[model samples]
Target: MSTTPLEAGIIPLVDAAPLIIAREIGFAEEEGLDLRLHRAPSWSSLRDMLALGQIDAAHMLSAMPVAMALGLGGFAERIDVLSVLSVNGNVIGCSLDLAARMRAAGYGFDFVDATAAGRALIAAAGDTPRIGVPFPFSMHAELLYHWLGALGVQAPQALRVVTVPPPLMAQAMAAGEIDAFCVGAPWGSTAVEDGVGELLLPTTAIRAFAPEKVLAVRHTWAEAEPDLTRRLMRAVWRAGRWLDQEDNCLTASEILARPDYLNVSSEVVERSLTGRLVISPRGDLRSVPNYLVFFRGAAAYPWRSQAALMAHSLAARSGLDRAAAVKAARSIFRTDLYRQNLRDLGAEMPGATDKVEGAMRDPTAVASEAGHLILEPDAFFDGFIFDPTGDE
Candidate 1:
């Protein structure tokens, strides 16, 4: 079915930085399609917009696509999750009050030893700690959940879970509404610089190169627009490669901080993008690369292991079926789309499928099974509320 070129509209956000940069920077144009970028109010707002066909696709949360597939979200008439937008760009932050007390009680940048670090942080909190997350079905919430659980503290018992918008996280912390927050770029970096909070931990240390977000579209829409989907993925893939360029980091940072995008200061965006995070007043901003990965570095290969880990996470949290959970998750996390994107750009695929660990101590391995990349799911979780109708 042929349609008007550039007829599709895409919604944007901080996580959508790459897609925005891809368009503003020409990767979208190279695909020979006209693109429209729209800003959404929130995740559910964007999901509803995409599901209603108000937009062709979206810069979405990694779990958003799968959540829709499993009817874990609104108007859950299944949708096809096409590709990853970026990876491992999130950070765990704590307020100055909490940070000081933790330091006074002996908790520092101990990324590898997540278990002990979480216990100490929680212990530093005199009573129930109020932590903010961007959304209910976000990597922020899941990562925080797993990391805190490492200390034998479940999200419900150990602390209070608060839903603060990404943009408002820093302000909420500064106001003492939240003691800590798990969030993606700019905001986390913004908090630390504004003297409201401290970025005590990088998510990479918690979940090495974890899948952070993706491009999602209605499954029926994807089936009908196969060529468009391929073209779209290729365009974003090229954009990813461009963003990964060291020199382009500054330029990309400028694009993300525009009022139409993250709506924060460019200085704040650069802090996260250029690997310079402001820890405190007296010291320098620590280097954290690929903070806001877009193109290939973050968006390039859709690791099967990343998909499996999301399943393990959702299963562990919600008690969904692990095997069935794996199937449903794999249905949306499309590596096939990723391959097309990489091929058009003439980029060689990653030499080998590597094992990635999520927030859990367990490792997720990737292997070829039945011509598909198979990632190992967690065995410990057997209880989750899964609707079988969505299972493929």
Candidate 2:
């Protein structure tokens, strides 16, 4: 049988592992997909490639499809998030000088206490700090806003936001173009390794199990080639499950460290996979077990509640119609597609598409088609929970 050829655009990041692993370990081939991976220089380029039909799917920021669906970035297209690719892989860090200032100001570099850390950063940077994020429409940007706003730091007034691709984040910081950044591994590890920045906290510190990236497919293509889309999701889903295994961390790290992948050392990539992050040039290590999740606790499921929360965040900034955007965002997540594709695969399909985001305080068993789905803790550090009804 002839294999269906599909191409995906991705930036070099550790969370892109599932897509790479799908191709590397024959998961794609097993599902009759001839998957070709293309490397984009930046998120904007990757977004354009996906929007322009240059690729069949993309390893995209979790918020990208919703942002596009809501017509935020000037270029609007119907996109579907087939499933979440990775969760909670991002870290916030500052230049070594800023790190020193923050440390000198009596703030210990403990990975917990995100509020205290933000307050310390505010105190350390008296002037507005120029912070870089991968894209304006990214979880990095949203979380930065969420974290800073929680501490009463008015954005663009207390801190300036700029765009720096993941690969160039460390260089930008080193060159003083950006004072700090919120980016995913191994780029955070790269910044620390290069002696330029110190990792302060994982984004999970702000919102544990925060949706990060998605296995995104253009909606038109998915509708036209349903079988191909389902096959691709199943293939990548299997790869994500394989990646979450503790035993596969080392090998997964080595594979992602190849030049065509993250192009960093296996040791750097391994830090994220193992959740043992080297936070500073001084080799300060912090263990963040929920730092990066692939398949655990229904991480891959495209929860509509998450989409609603992101839509709310974006709505606040853009002054978009909150209700309409939330509805559109929820629709774009394509939870139905995820369920349709993976239900028969013995996956523990969630009983409900929407939930109270950031409400779970511990491992709680939820209703599932498979009868057993224990969800991980997903509380915001500030103890705020999102009402899916837009009640706040």
Question: Pick by TM-score: which candidate is best?
Answer: 2
List model 2 lDDT by residue over 300-346, tens digit each: 99999999999988987888888888989998898899888998888
The pairs that clash in candidate 1 are 6-34, 240-295, 240-296, 277-285, 319-383, 319-384, 319-385, 320-384
Model 2 lDDT at residue 256: 93
Which portions of model 2 miss their true places by more than 4 Å?
none
Candidate 1, residue 107: lDDT: 74
Best by lDDT: 2
lDDT of each: 0.67, 0.89
- The stretch of ten residues in a row with the least summed lDDT in candidate 2 is 150-159
